[model samples]
Target: MPALVVFDLDDTLLDHRGAERAALADVHRMHAAHLGHHGVGHVQDTYHAHNVPLWRDFGAGRITAADLKRLRSERVLHALEAHDLDPETFSRDYLARYAEHWRWADGALDAYRAVATRFPVGVLTNGFSEQQRAKFARLPEVEALAAFAVISDEVGVRKPDPRLFEHVLGLARGVLDRPALAPADVLYVGDSFHSDVEGGVGAGWRVAWLRGDDARAPEGAAVVEDWRALLDLLEIA
Candidate 1:
């Protein structure tokens, strides 16, 4: 059976965290013009501090997408008391600017294309579809290498959930016009242990922990720090 390769989106394949940081800097500039230095950083700080928790809530199905966006804006506004800054309008404009500034990790495309020479590549990210599709637009090369692209919002399920893995795997198989490939034949590579690494293994695919600074994979999980090293781990080189 041909080995299928799956990848995570955020820090593993896409530089989302970096993109977010950069976007905040832009917000700082935009707000500083109107609100001054103290005012600008205030909004930036408040939003960054609150966004992760709100997103965690979002991931767990506790809130709607639109609600999360609006509330995030409202929280920042309330904290800074930035008058005339409407949460709804600010959120919409911020989303647009943020989406336009996506970046990809180094060696990501070369790594995928090298693997693509022999195996099918698919993306499985814990993100919304429209957001993800917009992200893909920023990295043209990465977009071309993948046979299937899956996101949590589009599938209505997040990583660590076996259903999302299975759905994406099915898409990869369909790309090859092959329906009988078991989950084990696919190789899943991701940055997060809790969601991507642990979850992929639970779904029966061989998991490869994409090394990041903040966390390590659970005991007994295989890991690859470099993108090219992935091919070597899979015995592709």
Candidate 2:
């Protein structure tokens, strides 16, 4: 068995996309007068176009998280032709609404409980410290289950970076009180291919990919469609 089991936060354990979609609804309703004619789909599409690239910039260290938020809001507003609306207000409102809908991915909490009962569990996620930590505040149960919740912004390195994985593995050594821990003795569970699978394999750790489609998991890695599948992969079910 692996010495430690690490989990990704957004989309893997939490319903991040679900919350974002709900939040968009809130933003659309709040700015109905300005955004009514264009429709919610247009606003959502515009937002994602700017949002994805801005996040890449942020991850690459070309821009700050604040810059990502501001730029995405501004660009989305411009694309939707909501000229009179304030970007700052739009950004703030969206985030506030997003926070209101925090929820766990289906069966994630149960999976966590199962694995954590047998192995030390930690969190490795790429996000700002405050924003990511706030997610725990909304789900105190999840917070209590983790041995450590490491954020990229806090450690100065993001996912897909070998350094971040090295850092977390080192911390796991201390958490488990095992100085001889090796990367291969850890199992990383996440939903992203580029960030989680590539990064975990690069770090020499075992990986269980929570891919909910027909896409195959990379060679030598476990593929799972949901939390229940993860339990089967671990042979704990």
Candidate 3:
């Protein structure tokens, strides 16, 4: 077993996409007048188109989290012609709803329990501190099992920035009481190809890419389609 098993919270362990869709539905309902003739699907597609690239920029150190949040909201509202709504207010409201709608990915709780029992488990995710904490607070199962959860907003750096991964590794070593722990002893799992797999591999750790559909896995990285597959990869099942 690996000395440490680290996970990315969004999409990998938590159903962030589900939460986002539900939150967007809430936001759309709340702002139907401002949103004009656009349906929820249009809004979701427009928002995702604007959001995904900004998140990639965030992971690449090309933009700050605050900038990504503000810009994505501004761009999405612009695309939807929702000029009457304030982007900042919309973003805040959406995030609040998102926090409340937290859901676990399939088998997340079981995988977390299994991993936590066999190895020190931690979370390294790129997200707002307060929102992430709120989600964790709602899921006592995850909170109790995690040895650490390092958020980019709190760390002032995001992945695939090496600093965030290094910080998690250092904390994992200390928490696991393995002073000599090295990169090889860690296995990092996440859904994003750039942020999780590339970042973990760049940090000299083994990576398990939690991919769906027909996404290609990078060389030397494990690819799993679901939490059950991930558990199998970790030898937890």
Which regions of candidate 1 deviate over 4 angstroms?
Answer: 33-35, 39-46, 79-84, 213-216, 235-237
Clashing residue pairs, candidate 3? none
Candidates 1 and 3 compared: the better one by lDDT is 3
By TM-score, the best candidate is 2
RMSD of each: 2.9, 1.5, 2.0
Error of 1 at 134 (Å): 1.9
In candidate 3, what are the lDDT values of residues 34-122, reduced to their tens digit? 97488898888888888899987876778876798889999999899899899988998898888888888878887888888888788
- TM-score-wise, the better of 1 and 2 is 2
Model 2 residue-pair collision total: 0
lDDT, model 3, position 139: 77
Angstrom error of the Cα, residue 178, model 3: value is: 0.9
Q: Rank order by lDDT, top first? A: 2, 3, 1
Query: Where is model 2 more than 4 Å wrong at Cα?
Result: 212-216
Q: Which 10-residue window of candidate 1 scores lowest in summed lDDT? A: 212-221
